[model samples]
Target: MSTTRHELLTAFDLLLAPERFKDYGPNGLQVEGRTTIRKIVSGVTASRALIEAAIHADADAIFVHHGLFWRGQDGRVTGWMRQRLGLLLGDDVNLFAYHLPLDAHPELGNNAQLGLQLGLVAHAGSAGRFGEQEIGFLGAPEDGATFTSGKKLAAHVERVLKRPVTLIEGQRPIKNVAWCTGGAQGYFEAAIAAGADAFITGEISEPQAHYARETGVSFLACGHHATERYGAPAVAAHVAAQLGLAHEFIDIDNPA
Candidate 1:
């Protein structure tokens, strides 16, 4: 049994609690299509490639972490933006997106999911106030894995995310960690204040490297797309299972 577009939106609103976040873009139903959804496609970003792939897959809707119409971007629908919106409209496919909510969700969030994948236990208490939203997560090595070196942790992240990870190593062993997926390098300072031995994020800036070196807190830039790839798929799978609709996660490669 397929679910209506409204039903899907309500489900996600309840699950991710979009109103709780002040995100860059809208969190649900960016583009409207058919009233009922039968097939859903999930991706990290709602790029032209991903949109085309979803069209090929005969998807009724496309769910993404990075949706169009960011905070500072021009509101005009021209050029590439127009092309992308046109494709979805022409194909009659809906677009759904969740940004900060996907990262902050306790159970299926990007940060939480990444921590579990890397054999770390989520510890909300570890990290203090971070930004307008507590999207980042703090974690510690799982029981029995008392210690993890910076090199080993980076290697494990690289292996799991299937991408090369850059590390700014610290002197101490990595006993506790803080992470937030996708271009969240600025959170490194918060991680240090939280007493995290290491901080992991999708991308890093010039200042972050200098901060890591001086602060003695290890930092990892683990590929923005790679780190955020899990959350949308997880959300789509859950939505599909809940609504009894078919789901597919289409991966479009982006090194950044």
Candidate 2:
């Protein structure tokens, strides 16, 4: 069955509540395509490959976490940008993207889903602030379960995410932990303030190493793409199921 673009967007907007966020990009319908959609494709980023893959898959709509437009980018439709836009426009494929909104959702957000993957029970709201938006999550192991040490936590992350985790070890025997899914190493200070024994994020900065050493909060960099693989797919599946459309999640892997 096909659903109108308006029906899909309204359902998603209500579900995600993007109005609550001050996002870097638009939360819905970045590009208009067909008015009705039967097949949808979802991915982490709206890269050229993913767009082309959507085209090949005969997807009427493409939903993603990282959209083409951003806060600081020039508003010109030229160069690589021109090509990407051309594909979407030429194919009449809808492009829907949600950046901070996708990251901030309590259940379907990247951080929350990652927490579930790692067996963490959400204990409190994220201490990390992005303007007024809380983009991270704070958690601990579920009752009667534990991750013995920082090394063990890192190993679990590596096993779950299927990527090599870079560990900056702190004090041993991790108990409380905090995490944000993508390129959020800067939130380590917030994690520390929240009394997290360990912090996990997608990317780490140079200064974060020293912060981890001095503050006794272990840091783990688990690759941005790897960390964010869950949210978009979850959102897509929900949207498709809600709108009675077929949804396929496409993984165009990126090492970064």
Candidate 3:
């Protein structure tokens, strides 16, 4: 089975709502490939390496969290940028990147999917002032299950990502927590201000270390790639289901 590029892009545009965000790169389609797609690949970034992998996999379309054409970027396509764009263009592969929009969706967004991974039910219409929706959320387990401590929560995260978690300073067991998807260390204040007991996000910058320590909040540094892979797959699965297109999610793993 196949779908036209225009048709697929239309479905995805409505699903992601790229207009809601001021993104670093072009949100929807970056490269126009074949008009019809039979297979789609999803990843965290359109890095040269990942793009190559998608090409090798014979993907017609690639979906990602970080796309090309970032904010404060040069208009000229040169060096790494030039090489990446060349690869996609030369191969006739279409690229679709979703940043904040993927992070904001209630059921299909990166933040929401991350929360669901850890058993969170997000509140409706709780997007922040930055138009950043809440990714981490508060929820009790379906069977009244519990995570005994910050250490335990960190351990669970480690188990899920298969990476060692960098535990930030915090105390006690937790059942109520909050989180955001992607590079959202800046949203820690939002989570804390929301009265959350703990917070989790994908990548953490240097300054966030001091912020977490001073705020008396526990932080966990799960690799960015590991944290974000879920949302796109979730979206792809739904899109494939909705439009009845054949979908295969290829994981081009990166230990970022």
- Give the Cα lDDT of each candidate: 0.86, 0.87, 0.75
lDDT of 1 by residue, 66-182 (tens): 998788888899999999999999989999999999988777878777777877777646253354477777777787464457788888888888888999988778887888889
lDDT of 2 by residue, 91-127 (tens): 9999999888888788888877888888886674434
Alpha-carbon runs more than 4 Å astray in model 2: 124-132
TM-scores vs. true structure, each candidate: 0.95, 0.95, 0.89
Better of 2 and 3 by TM-score: 2
Q: Give Cα distance to truth, residue 253, candidate 1, Å.
A: 0.6
What is residue 228's positional error in candidate 2, in angstroms? Answer: 0.4
Best by lDDT: 2
lDDT of 3 by residue, 60-179 (tens): 898887888777887898999999989999999999888878877778877777767766665444432222443355444434555676688888888777887777856635655677
Q: Which residue pairs come into collision in candidate 1?
A: none
